[model samples]
Target: MSAGTSQETPATARGGLFVTFEGIDGSGKSTQCRMLADTLRARGLDVVLTREPGGSDGAEEIRRLVLEGDPDRWSAETELLLFTAARRDHLERRILPALAAGQVVVCDRFADSTRMYQGLSRGDLRASVDQLHRLMIGHEPDLTILIDMDPAKGLARAKGRQGSEERFEDFGLDLQQRMRAGFLALAQEFANRFRVIDGDRPMDVVAQDVLDVVAAALPERDGDAGA
Candidate 1:
């Protein structure tokens, strides 16, 4: 993490910078999250790289329950509650503490994900998602990086992964298309905190754009990570 002081945001009261990545399935947000963390760590900054739905031990358990079952296994409402619960645990156990300790927190997905997946895709529960978020997880990331991709391409990449967490991908390409649109709408809804980047490019190209957006959001770093 860059030892250079990060800007304070109303969304994050703690000292650390809170960055989140969001996109349709297989948009490479997870890979980018890891790359960003690695880059920051190499610079000597204190960083905490984590993911939603499975960041904390408890959340990980819920992740399997929601992600491994059949697509019709749970109603949209039930899934929303489960995801919110997992997010709450993740926030309290991992995010809050890391921020309080003044470490940069880079999360692969956050509430905006719930806003897209549960709120828009599965059903018209965007209002409920916001209500639960305000009631349970009142915080938001300081910066949100939205990776925009062609839904079909993203779905193909997602299915190609052959991972156990295939519940969402099983929803098929139509759902992926809707989700891509929903995410773009969300980026507009929270324009100030969001930075949308085209994800159809090479990994290095996408990563460079992500880094540039992040750098614009943060203060210039002059000190070493250990400083």
Candidate 2:
């Protein structure tokens, strides 16, 4: 792992797990992320639930700047820079600490979001995005749960939600379609650490699949794996 992307202490080495959820908007990954965290905690595990662009104090401030403004407020490159800065702060202030304390850190989104977003928004900047990550943020989650869903449905779900954070969500179906493909490709590229969950099922079913993936990856303490 690169210095900028590494946890203060390796999560596995410290009995912690860092898991991230990624998907196009309305993929239900957010709900599943929370559900998984709750399930883990109920099983007697320490769990920290956080989200990208706004996990740590500093990152939250950056999130406001990135998510609340006009869509074109910042150029693609500048926006990616802002995201990287926020991610760095999130790692240093919240995520890394939780992992060092042996807590499962479940992030709603991580570096992969940047990779896909920029790849879709500013197609030519994908290389820059990867380079920046390599130079300043070089860590991968123990597992990434990609809630795969149809873009049209995902877009409708995102638009139906009430939020001022529609900057990304407002990109519409076409972009969401591309993002879905990007995430699937990413899953293939990082198959060892990626779980592509079919999210078209009922919420309960989706949540259970997510739980199963996580439980299998990080067996619970004592006899709690099935808990």
- Among the numbered candidates, top lDDT falls to 1
Candidate 1 global TM-score: 0.92
- 1-227 per-residue lDDT for model 1 (tens digits): 11012232343467777899999999999999998888778877788999988899999999999999699999999999999999999989999999887778899999888988888899999888887877788788889999999999999999999999999999999999999998888887778788999999999999888877766655345234322
Residue pairs in collision within model 1: 1-40, 1-45, 44-225
lDDT of 1: 0.85
Against the true structure, what is each candidate's TM-score?
A: 0.92, 0.92
Which regions of candidate 1 are displaced past 4 Å? Answer: 1-12, 219-227
Candidate 1 global Cα RMSD: 5.4
lDDT of 2 by residue, 111-195 (tens): 8899888745546677788778877876778889999999999989988997999887776777898899989988887777889
- Full-model lDDT, candidate 2: 0.84
Candidate 2 vs. true structure, TM-score:
0.92
